[model samples]
Target: MRDFLTKKITDIQPSGIRKFFDIVSEQPDAISLGVGEPDFDTPSHMTQEGVRSIQEGRTFYTANAGLIELREKISDYLLFRNKVNYDPKTEIVVTVGGSEAIDIALRTFVDPGDEVIIPQPSFVCYEPITQIVGGTPVTIDLKAENQFMLTPEELEGVLTEKSKILILSYPNNPTGGTMDREALIKIADVVKKHDLLVITDEIYAELVYDEPFTSIAELPGMRERTIVINGFSKGFAMTGWRLGFMAGPEMFMEQLLKLHQYTIMAAPTASQYAALAGLKNNWQETVEPMRLSYEERRNYLHHALEKMGLTCYKAKGAFYLFPQISQFGLSSEEFALRLLDEEKLAVVPGSAFGKSGEGFIRLSYAYSIYELKEAIQRLERFVTRLK
Candidate 1:
């Protein structure tokens, strides 16, 4: 079996974040902010729909491209919410989740030894998935001074002829940084000039606070050169449902669709039916309240971290508060582990995302206000003990 496995399988590194979780899994009464998922339960209406489908015997295979009704809703949602237009028939493909969508996107575009540019202090999956497909992951560190935003100069510096894919993940995981229209325009200009293809992970698109989350695909020429990856996970608290979709140029999506056909065939049929309901009538009622709750939590967590004298950038979107922990005289991992072991409070080390995250620690505010207050108290006591 070992001899039969491919060289690529041997070259991959196990996920760094999962290692910590495994060690702490048996601990008692730990207050965890380690996972990047929403603490909220999947919306009841969506779940009911899934149940209804299963009861009605709708448990069969779906089209490789997914249900046409679902595709149309995705197209409509993109256009209505972000002013981005995609053809339902050609540009859209329902994926297992944002993870599978990202994997498919990378596999379809990246050839062996091709370099894919990723902004660091971003998501953990990009590098591992790129390596899986034989692509070289080129990381560009987004500076804290720039509010963790990627600059055009950074993009220009790293991008070479071998760079086939550029992943833009904003409302970014771990950092909670997001790009506005002007920032996206700068990167879009660079992408256009370089003739590069962008695979944008906008899963947290609906969680913005101060400014609207702009898609690079909305920019001129970018729509044709961009693959938009989004899902119901962050926005609708639908993480367990494993539903996501990709929209891009027809020619590229054709290749991706074929890959999906061979690898997974299709997303869960019942989940597709439930997501169709989510995309249609229940979207506003089920999703907006959760967004508002997350926004409130963001404010609470940001202020609490500030009062505790930790340097924190005000996140524009997503549910994380990444605080600089260098003042505690420990690396990110040490700080995180010590807090979990001593204070019984769990937050992810920033280094789990990338090397750029070395001096910071990421805290999620997806839990209730009462729980957050309790966790913050533990953190405060932990810091005092350190001193």
Candidate 2:
């Protein structure tokens, strides 16, 4: 028999989220906050536009770089919102989703054995994709004291000649951490010293609260060296749309666009049309309600966790709360599994994000207020038994 499996594919672990999702599916009436996806339906105008695009027979393949109008609109949107400018023609490539964008960016830049710097308690894709591309994933643990933001001091400690890419994900996954301009500037200083390329996942950029969002691309000398990975997934509740894009230096785009062209061909045509409406019309109607709702959930969960005697940080963006559970004297995985099996509540262990997350558990507040209240009640019941 032939040993047929490729090492790269064989070595990778399956998604931590999917592992739990399959479990929750088997249990009747389970309440799941384990997944990071938005519970809201995709906006109406976007759906109508997508159907209209299909009815008009616009289903043929778009350019590998994506529709020029969409790309240009993306450029304008980035410039206007993130204060980061990019040229649509040469500097951007639309991808299947932010996931694909992340993979392409790594595939384009990571030569065999190149090192990628990642912050812990981040979205899981960063490290796995880096490993699949034959890059070393160096994880820097972001602590609760820092609001889970990666520090420049930590960046300096990990630098080596092999380090090629730095992935900055904020408002982060699981932890809901975000970096302000000052924190980013400090990071920029280290990046400048190390001369590294940054692959920033700002998928949660539009979901921020209390403070304005900042993009690393807006840093001086950063736009050219940073590839900004964003998409319609989190912002427009378009996870199923599978539409995302990346903007960076033309040289990098030349490589990423090539990979996108050869592999994905183009992002889904109907989804792109829907995204066009998303980018232009109904922007506020689509995202604002979801953002406001998540903010409320964020505050509710934070306070609720505190009231239950868990130490929780203020989650500035994204819909998750990473609460320290060391007081419970259980590993994060034990806490999560017991909560699911005994309580019919589904939440992910923070350790699933990284070792730094071992003492915490991540609860997604993307669910409704009523559901959140129920979850809090269940959690309090579980905690009462813990004593």
Candidate 3:
């Protein structure tokens, strides 16, 4: 037999986040701040709705695009919340999760040899997914000095004739950085100049710590060219439900919907109905409380890291703390490994995100304040010994 797998996939690396997670799982009494999942369960109402879905025996596949009612609610949510408008009937397609939404959008838009400008240290999926589709990833290693927000200059520098897409994940992962309206306008100008389509992953849209989250698509002339990705996982504490959606212009969505139909068929039926109930109640009941909890966790972790003499950009969104581990003369991986081995504490190496993340480690604050506090004590012990 010849080689089993294609070189494209074989050459791609597995997620850095998962590597530490696996190791931590084997360590007895280990405290992992690695995975970026919420500690909260699916709110009772949403769970009950899913239960209702099963009780009513409405477990059949939904429309290829999803329930029109759910789509309408999503549309309304986007309009009222993110300041973007899409016709639910034609423009929104609920997906398995934001992960699938990203995969489908990249598949539909990118062609072989096309260049995708991705800002680092971003979510780990974008580069590999671009490669899987035969697209070239052009990385703009974001700087902490700039608060990890992607700059227009940084974006403009990487443009090429083959540049087909720009993935903007604000209220970002790993670093928890966010871009406000002014920052977005500058990016929009560059996108317009380059004529690039954007996949704005606003999965953390509801968790912005400062101003309300703004979608790049909300800007003038950007909606026609941007696909907004969001989901029920983080804010709604429905990660297991596997429900997410995409909002974009009809031209892109019609074809994206066709691809989703052939590939996924439709998102799970019970999950859709459960999500519908979530939206019908406007999501505030669950989301607001989770956001506040995450903020509290963020503050506690931020202060703890500060007290340890580690400096990092204070996260403005999402539930992560990316503190620099370089001062101790250890690589991100080494620091994480030593911490896990010696203190039984687990955090993801920043290098897992991208090369620019080499000297940092990412700690998710989605865990309870109690766990975060315990994790901090272990981390403090580790850091003190290192010093």
Candidate 4:
């Protein structure tokens, strides 16, 4: 069995975020701050929309590109929010999830041996997915000093003749970083010069707290070269719905939809309706409150970590906190393991995201304030012992 396994697949490690939670399942009483999932339920109206779709016998397949109505909704959404226009009929492919968009986008644009420049520590899937798609994953280690936003200088340093695609994941996972509009323009100029395509992961676009979220696609010369990936999972709390979409130039989107049709056929029927309802409904009625809650949680968690004398980088975009634990003289994995073992609290080792994540651990503040308070007390107890 081992001999028959594909060497490429075998080389990839299981998700680091899930590792501690497996221990958490045994601990029973253990509090897990590991998973990036939102603690909120999908808004009731959206759930009812899914239920309605099924009750109305709409359990069939959608169009290969997704329900046209949903695509229009997504189209209006990008145009309104980001000022980037995409033709709903030609440039959108509804996917199983943002994960699938990531996969298909790579399939559409990346050829074997193409170099994909990625920034770390980022979401866990990018490197493995790049490898799986037969592309070389060229990673740029992002620093806390830079707030993890990729600089033009850093991006320029990694470019080569083989560099075909660059992935920009702002409202970055694991680190919670966001790239401001000013910074994105500089990055865009470099990308234009190099003629590289970009896959910008904007799944957390609506949840940004610091300033208005900026999409690279909005920058001049970037929309044509960029694929925008977004979904209901993060902003609409629709992880289980598993609905996402990618928008790009008609040329690229045509290829993405072709691959999606063969690989996934279509996203689930009811999930599309559910996502449509999410976009159709008032943002203030549902997602805004959730974003505000996340912002509050972000502040509280940052304060708690600071009060513990830990070096916590205040990330303004996503829900996770990457608090440095290097002062305790332990690897990020070692710190996370001991904290889970003795404190019965679960968090992810930063190295799971990438090697650049060493000396830090990721804690998702998407949990309740009550859960956060309890976790902090346990963390304080753990930290006191280290001292």
Q: How much is the lDDT of residue 21 in candidate 3?
A: 80
Q: For model 1, name the residue pairs that clash.
A: none
The residue ranges of model 4 lying beyond 4 angstroms of the native Cα positions read none
lDDT of 1 by residue, 25-125 (tens): 86868998777889888777778888999999999999999999999999999997768888999999999999999998898898899999999998889
Model 2 RMSD in angstroms: 1.2
Off by over 4 Å in 3: none
lDDT score of residue 247 within candidate 1: 94
* Tens digit of per-residue lDDT, candidate 4, span 1-387: 799999889998888877756767888888889878899999999999999999999999989999999999999999987898899999998999999999888877888999999999999899998998799999999999988889999999999999999999989998999999999999999999999999999999988887999999999988888999998899899898898999999988888888998999999999999888887856547888999999999999999999999988898887999999989999999999899999999999999899999999999999999999999999999999999
Where is the poorest 10-residue window by lDDT in model 3? 278-287
Worst 10 residues of 4 by lDDT: 278-287
Please list the C-alpha lDDT of all candidates, in the order they appear.
0.89, 0.89, 0.91, 0.91
TM-score (C-alpha, index-matched) for candidate 3: 0.98
Give the Å shift of residue 351 in candidate 3: 0.7
Model 3 clash tally, residue pairs: 0
Q: For model 2, name the residue pairs that clash.
A: none
Pairs that collide in candidate 4 are none
Model 1: CA > 4 A from native? 1-5
> Candidates 1 and 4: which is better by lDDT?
4
In candidate 2, which residue ranges exceed 4 Å CA deviation? none
